[model samples]
Target: MDTSSTPRSAVVLGAGIAGLAMARVLHDFFDAVVLVEPHPLPADDRPRGGVPQAHHIHGLTARGLDLMEELFPGLDRELEDAGTPRLDHGRDVLTCFPTGNAPRVDTDLGSRLSSRALMEARIRGRVLALPNVEPRTGLRVTGLVTDAARSAVRAVATDDGGTVPGDLVVDTTGRFSRLPRRLADAGFPTPPTRTIDAGVGYASGLFEAPDQSWLALIQPTVCPDRTRGAYIGKLEGSRWMVTLVGACGDHPPADQEGFRAFADRLDNPVVAAFLAEARPVSPLHRYVRTENHRTDYHRMPAWPDRFLVAGDAVCAFNPLYGQGIGVALEQALLLRSLLAARTGRSTPSGPVGVAGVAELTGLAREFQRRLPRTTGYAWRMSTFQDAIWARHRAGRTTRRDRAVTWYLDRLYRAAAADPATAATFARVFQRAAPPTALLGPRVLLRILRGG
Candidate 1:
């Protein structure tokens, strides 16, 4: 490694949202940044072979939209130009609470709804246009190149018969990353991992929308006997992305007729109506691997100095909550800030370079600290809800369970009638506001007043 180089070199593994965003941020500090992906990059909005979830619906929450705007200025306009639908979360979405049917409240917080492929394609285009960023598709990283002491990653060995050397390496390989095992093989201890499985499954299908600009309806079901939920959203090109989800023992079937029956069972008639009117553009895509998994690599006593993991590789959450893209964007911003702090103070070759290493380690630790709080909250909430539903299905209910369910019924009814309460729920959904906000005095008053 030549410290005298005018700018640093960075290698980012995986060409997903996290990898692309990290490469964009790395370009600010490093002279060159390389992004490696396994599949051939798509030249248009067509799906790539890499991301299996591209067929599923993806929602950019209000908070995620804000983060995306900061990362890529004018991204909203770009998405709009590309036919992505902009939705007012409270206004456009008619949310049906489990307790009872109430008049839907129209609030103002907005979210952008689009196909995962379209959103990724837009971001990938901008990232590839960066002068210092190069995207190399169809090349897979087989192993890490380490020094004689095997203490630091000197480069990465790829299937393409070449070594891509850099000052740092980041693994953004999603949930299937082998970086942790690779690091352990290279002499580091295996990192601590935690996983919570709720046995949730997803079935998604694409259809042509009846209207061009109307927001898609999302109906969340809480069948104590079934523990199922469904979501529908409008995607680019006037297409509807509908996903039917189930937790615990209630699973959506992969067969077309069975999936339609599941959608018809939803508390709301909108999903069934849309399915009847719209023709399926693709086969029913099913995914049953939804689990909350996280690795504490930064907590390791002796992690490789030049390597770190980000995105789903660090923490993968249940996609039902739609936190994947938002978390990836936040990780990219954090990485950018850490690198900027290092570059602002000293040249790449100056001093011991110890300070840069320390800064990077601290950034990794900060991310690890936040990981549990983010993923754990969703994991607990989902599992707890699912457990309650399971018990209800089994015909066993304690007094405490009955009381809690009653309170939640009241809260949902209040949320539908009160704008302030609805906003609080929206914030929590977006991960922009803490769960404590739901307990605020104003919201409590509404719940008490029978709103």
Candidate 2:
């Protein structure tokens, strides 16, 4: 299965952040990479047909920014040159967690906040610059083409009956991917799935803000009785992106008055006051696809040899946690590491690392198995609060739920009173440290002492 002579080819589905990142990594490992997209991509930072939430606020977590910089060198500088300032999480940003306003002690955790389209454009430009990569836009992936044995994906069939053949295929087609149906059609077992539907909805819009120095003012919806929240973040082009969010079937109205009313419902009056005076730059865009869904591909007894799934196609989390981009970048980095280790490449690029189609079987399975572990903490962090809110509304709470609720309540109080505990909280929230770090003996003692 050595791919020493003939160059290895790869077909990556979708042209969103995940797809672009995957294609970039594959370009380093394969001889040729073909990125297929269903929509015609614009050259500028404009919303495309595929991403409905493009106008919404998107934060590149500290970890996500680091990974982006690693993948495309000088990306941080490029963003800064474009007038995107990196704000310190504690010093420059105001965060109102569910437990009330988080303590704003200066810390190293921070990220560059920008509209999704702008960030995507920068990454997309870098990805397309790779000589080994080519993008196929305006082509829908119908299904996967397998070899005679039907065990490995040999090519991807497009909507027009054309097939793009490749040595390997990766699916980054986002949440609405047809991969499950395609796999079932190929006589392969579909993966097990789990979902926690928060029933959250939001209305996002752009506004002209005089202030352009800070990052964001976030007030997330608290649990129990509170169901409304707001986020006002600095976007490119000297505009502000304001989003009013509600969960558990409470949707922000798309109309101007309704949007203002929703913003007013937030605990903080700052958002509503600002919206009252700030000039609206865009119509209120409503989005309702906020659910935590995960497909356990690792549990499948059999997997296609040359096929794999990443990003939202595998695990889509609630947007409130701001972990989507971070998780996607981490997944791409993981894919690169797996390929490099398998190919024995000193670095990501050089000679083709994969030996043959047979080798892909193990790599695909291993990747799927390891992918769940990467997203477990993030998934838990998102679903836990949503579950608490859901159960609070239903008036049905289990012992475990009460225990978790009690522990978190005390933890948040401790974080507000103690700087060290607050830093630990920020570390975990930024994904620099594991969640277990917050549950340690010292943190528990701090909570017991009523910090």
Candidate 3:
């Protein structure tokens, strides 16, 4: 992995956020990087055949936004100039719950509230703009070409009966990645899998509404009490991206009338009132694959050399939690750190620091094992709430999880009244801070005191 005259090459699968970030990182360490995707990517920000969630609402967490800015310098300004609305979550987003609405005041958490398509388009555009990076759009990845001893991935097989050789191959194909089967076919060890499907479905639409009260409206789904949720936000172009979510078969209908009806069913009247007057700009799009899937690659007894997995392919969370992008960004930063360390780069180009480089095993193996240290919290933050829904009980529900949920309920209720508690809640849930932030003395005291 030496950056000096090693002439390393990398082939990254998928064109999603993970793949884009990985390609950017590989460009730093490798002499050449090839980014491959099966779908025909359009120049504009339109939904493609591969990504089903492109049409839905997607928010960048405060930390994810910061990481993206680091990965692609001046991206924040670029997004803002592109009409992506930047808003402080504490004040710009009016959050509601079954009990009531939380007070919107000044706090630290903020995001560039753009549609997923727009963000992806911007990131992919910047990534592909790199001189050393090559793009293979519309080329399907059929399988992996293994070495003679079948110990490592030597190249990637495409649908056109061609192979793209590389020193390293990365899988960022998200939840539906075929890397496992490809590994098994190569006589390599494939990891065990676990999934927690909440049966959550989404119906989203675009609208043009003049609601200056707040930049976004969020009514969260707190199971057993609230099964329906609404996220209405204005993305670039002054157009509103309204996404309605329902758990346990309570899906939102993909029609104008039904979309409005679902919004009206929410406890908050703000969501319905805004949509009631908005002009529909697009038809509703429904997405139903919101399961929490965990592929235990870190625990795999044996892993192939020169091959690795990252992003949703390893740990895909429920989309409702908005942790997918944040986790991917984290994984991207981690990749940079491990790569920079392995290559003996004195300083990483980004703002992210390589703090734990000396303790790593190999780059490929250590990436998978150490990832859970950061990703596990996001996974728990997402899946814990969904586990309580009578229909979402797929994983083991221990007494600890029940206790965590109980405390989270209290924290949610407290967040409704106390600004400090709400800010902590926002930071923790935003992935800007750790879960320990919720258990801090002041926040813990506020939660215990019944804010």
Specify the highest-TM-score model's number. Answer: 2
| Local distance difference test, candidate 3 | 0.80
TM-scores of the candidates in the order shown = 0.87, 0.94, 0.91
Name model 2 segments beyond 4 Å from true.
1-5, 97-100, 212-214, 350-361, 393-395, 449-451
lDDT by residue for model 3 (1-451), tens: 3233446678999899889988888777666788888887778887666788888888988888888887888988988999988888888888886657778878778798888888888888888887888888878888888767775677888999998887778899998888789888778787899877777889998999885788988888875557799888889999998899998779999988887778878857787678767998988999988889999988888776777798999999888788888788888888878777665784655323222323223667878888897588878887777766634345455776677667867778888878777777777877778888888998788768864
Model 3 residue 301 CA deviation in Å: 1.3
lDDT of 1 by residue, 102-206 (tens): 344555567788888888888999888888788888888888888887767878898979988878888899987898878866787888887666567888988
Candidate 2 structure, TM-score to reference: 0.94
Worst 10 residues of 1 by lDDT: 346-355
* Candidate 3, number of clashes: 0
| Better by TM-score, candidate 3 or 1 | 3
Score candidate 1 by TM-score against the native. Answer: 0.87
Q: Model 1 clash tally?
A: 0
What tens-digit string does per-residue lDDT give for candidate 2 at 1-451? 2345666888899899998988888887777899999898888878777798797888877788888888878988888888776877776766666565666777898689888888889999888888888889889988888878887788888988899988888999998877899999898997899888767898899899678334688776756556888888886688888888888789999988888876776757566567767998798899998888998888999888878899999999888788888888889889888887777664866425356545465788788889987788789888988887667667786788788777777887787677778878777878888889998888989988864
Clashing residue pairs, backbone N/CA/C < 3 A, model 1: none
Best by lDDT: 2
Q: Which stretches of candidate 3 lie over 4 Å from their true place?
A: 1-6, 348-361, 390-406, 441-451
2 versus 3: better TM-score goes to? 2
How much does each candidate deviate from the true structure in C-alpha RMSD? 4.0, 2.2, 3.8
